[model samples]
Target: MSASHTHGDCCDHQDRHQFSLRKALIPIAVSALLFVIGLLFNKALNNTPYSVGEYAVLIPAYLISGWSVLITAGRNILRGRIFDENFLMAIATLGAIAIHELPEAVAVMLFFQIGELFQDYSVGRSRRSIKALLEVRPDTANLKLGDQVREVDPKSINIGDLILIRPGEKVPLDGEILSGQSQVDTSALTGESVPRTVVTGETVLSGMINQSGVLTVRVTKPFAESSISRILELVENASSKKANTEKFITRFARYYTPVVVVLSLAVAILPPLLIAGATQAEWTYRALVLLVISCPCGLVISIPLGYFGGVGGAAKRGILVKGSVFLDALAQVKTVVFDKTGTLTQGNFRVTDVISENGFTQSQLLALAAQVESQSNHPVAQSIRQAHGKSVHKSGVQEYEEIAGHGIIARIEERTVLAGNDRLLHRESIPHDVCIVEGTVTHLAVDGEYTGRIVIEDELKEDAIAAIQALHLQGIQTVMLTGDNQAVADRIAHTLGLDQYRAELLPEGKVAALEEILDRASHTQGKVAFVGDGINDAPVIARADVGMAMGGLGSDAAIETADVVIMTDAPSKVAEAIAIAQRTLQIVWQNIILAMTVKAIFIGLGAVGVATLWEAVFADVGVALLAIFNAGRILR
Candidate 1:
């Protein structure tokens, strides 16, 4: 009985999870059919007078294509909001019918729905793209209950539950593999194409697809707190935080629509009352034409849609822009500050040279260093351990103390092991040999005597130099802030041609350094963007005008807090995102210019009684269609 109940619950949940997108396209199909029939009726009545049959046919066509708009106008009227597009289109077409222009009224509503259909399509396309990007959500988990493996909803599983994942199945929840080995594809979250190899005791995140092996994983996090769930939450709330341009357009439409309504009213009443030659019928016709031009649907619809397209295009390239505000800020950035380790460089250290003093074997020095360094996970320390090539048990080490940004101090069986920078040796009053090296040097002192210096280096990313050059080409300055020594920082700065460098800084120091760069950029009213691999740089990323996180191997704090997440851990995406923002802005301004110029000309002619209803329709509906298509160019 319990098994059947759970199975039924799963089936019901699966039905709800699947959305019928075809249902949304039904209205579009109906509107298109009515549009075609309306056109046919208009062509048939061009040379003939319409009777009751024609009125009956045209009225239904208008209602079939525009019932939703009519209902929305009525509802908004009851709510005391009457100057929106629905009201404008409804009033204009109803007035045409009152003037006995039956065919024109149907045509107006048909064309209006055509424009509306495109608007719906644009909005739907954007929403669908975001949904598809988040398609990583797993529907069911293979729950392992003793010897039985049963299917269950992911939400029904809890922490510490054992789950089995087969080949090509998504990891249902964040967990650690209890057994088995396989390669898991994490491209859904990180945007990297390469599948990561995993074995027993390795933790795997939700939304990753397992390939080539069966595995048992112990759930570590619930479904609500998973990675894909958080991404969905971010996207769902993104639109509430509008861009500056979107807000301006919202306020503009609030006044622009009502004012134009009053203008149309004045054109209808005042001209007939003040001018002797003007008749009521002629001026009222002109008033109807003026009403059609009053709606700024072209500008209002296209601008936001253009920004959405830009964001969708960026998503396709593995960049997640949380909102248009960040996209707007990205366009105006004059300076970009970068975190050094794990950002500009690979963050993987390799020992270049091991200098030994006083006839001590190099192997003895490395073994001593690894014994102490194995206690820490610092990148340089790991490099030393890797170079040592032999594992040193940590049980023999005693009294370990870590000095921030400098080095470490430990005792290996009564032999004091100091493995760190020059500052660490100086602080301990240990006389150490000064070794001039191009790469980072970790000084090692044994029993307060200078032994040798080990040189470790983190090579620059393959695209770091090119990324800096591209930013320079765009007239943007670049700065690097790291906790490395001055020598290492200067070497990287010179090689990358950066404008400035701040070395040997703590996390707080990085934030302070960012403030200095931001203050300098204030003179130009420009923004500053800080890009990092996203773990230790969260504070600086939060303080910048735009926080761009390299998200291929991202941390949750950075991915959630940063406004922009570059999916691939490549610096080049930073420059590419800026280009997309600039291009979006360019298209927005073009739509503004195109819509305003055409509307001004048509409205001027409309006010003078020279423009016909046909001209008015084209000025309103045709311009909207053109601007929407123009906005589509952002994706290209």
Candidate 2:
């Protein structure tokens, strides 16, 4: 007698469904058993019409099975909301009872309850699957407080606090490793299977598991701002931004139920009064059947479920779609614009070539350059040191100076060694053979004499070529935008077979270039998506039709401004996101067509008296279950 049903609010509905199955089973069983007894009693009475024994047995069964529907319908009517599945089922069954069809009335309510139970089970399973996919939020942290570790909630841990991460335990907060070494598993966040090794001075993020060795970490960010928290927040709130198809279905159902009710009333009243041979009882029976068939439960439940499945599926692949509306936009993207650094190319710089001059050997040139560049922490300097592959001792070095926007001037072992860009050489009047280089270059000078030049270039990611090819296969144009010189940009574009390239653009220039791309796209063509990871890429990312950020190495501004975050920092996932969106949309439309087709056929048959009340119940509940199952396919 305590049965209740919910219509809107997907989270509330899912919570109710998660627990409703067990509560509903006992009442349904009792109602079904009593209905069987009532049928046997009616048979014993030789098919008597309106028999007292039949009413006594079957009326209780009908009330027991349908008490929730009747009460909900009455409450909604009082609240001035009269059109829903509950109203439809209540009216149809009550009309059956009025026509002395006690068995049919009881059967309808019992079958409807059975359908509700199945729906509960289906939705609960989906909710559990999605929960399992996003179960990355760490529950506790081991706070290392002065030689004693205390188990505490991750949220209670503050910045600058020390935390001990044991082997096989998850890192509780984003922090730098102060001591110890470990191989950490980042699959929970990045969807990558390979374990990453971490040592002292390396930073580890939250939600990563420590595979081996203990790590003493100094926390940098609180739990609220951790990577895991941001991802969970995006997923939990994704349903709030529904797609256009979902919104349209919601509005369609609101008015659909009322129109069906009016049409059913006309079917019952107008036929008997207008036709000579049409009896009121027969036409009324058809009206009840029509009412039962007209419920829009399939469309109401399946559309949102489909989108929820899509979001969960994307999360599993290290792609975080902020909302279903963004998913829709991704499916229609015709052009994918990429930022050169850290997006298609690995942002890490490496020394590619070393050109020597002025009687300096390659080894001596690199060693001298590395010794001077060692005083700097720039990425280009780091690449030089890494290439030298030896530690530099500053013991005999003097007068270490860094020229902003130029290079470095340091006197090592009484030698004035200069390591910087061409501007530095030009400022010192040191003449060099090459005034311009294809890629990033650093010129070295000793005692104001040109010694050599080091060529450093950012390497393309391993999957960069494959990613562009995949997008091209989908008929999407691929473009690259960068501030690198024209030679470097042309080389990368030709190597990746990109459709276009724009070079030497500043941050604002990148935004203007994106706008021009947007302008060239016709309204009938698709949208433009921009993929980037740097702080400078934030503005253009926000301007794109669908902004995708490389979450693994992307700056905070880029991630916050992006509509979709690719956690793996793989350009290939851009194409994958579009594929998932297209698949979700396809399944959604299939469900819509399936539900509408079944309802139209059954509604017409019921009105013409060819379909009985039993068929109408099957048509309504059966289509809903099928659609629910179909929507769940996206999770797979």
lDDT score at residue 168, model 2, on the 0-100 scale: 86
* lDDT tens readout by residue for model 2, 450-499: 99899999988999999999999999999899876677899899999999
- Backbone clash total for model 1 is 0
As for candidate 2, its clashing pairs are: none
Candidate 1's C-alpha runs over 4 A off are 1-50, 144-148, 156-162, 175-183, 190-203, 215-221, 352-377, 381-404, 407-419, 426-430, 444-454
Per-model lDDT: 0.80, 0.83
Stretches off by above 4 angstroms in model 2 are 1-6, 9-13, 16-26, 35-42, 45-67, 353-438, 442-454, 552-555
Model 1: lDDT of residue 630: 82
**Tens-digit lDDT track for model 1 on 1-636?**
111121122123223444344653565466556556656775555445655555656777778766766886787688777677778778988999888776677767667766766655655565555766578889999999999999999999999999999999998888889999999997776666889899997888888899989999999888988767766676666666668887777777778888988988998999878988999988888989888876677877788778888787777676788988888999999999988887899988999888888667788888888888988868888889989998689999899998777788898898988888876887889875565678888888888888888888898999999999999999999999988888889999999999988987877889989998899899889999999878768888999999998853326767677998886668988999999999888888898899889988989999997888878877888888888888787776
TM per candidate? 0.86, 0.85
The top-ranked prediction according to lDDT is 2
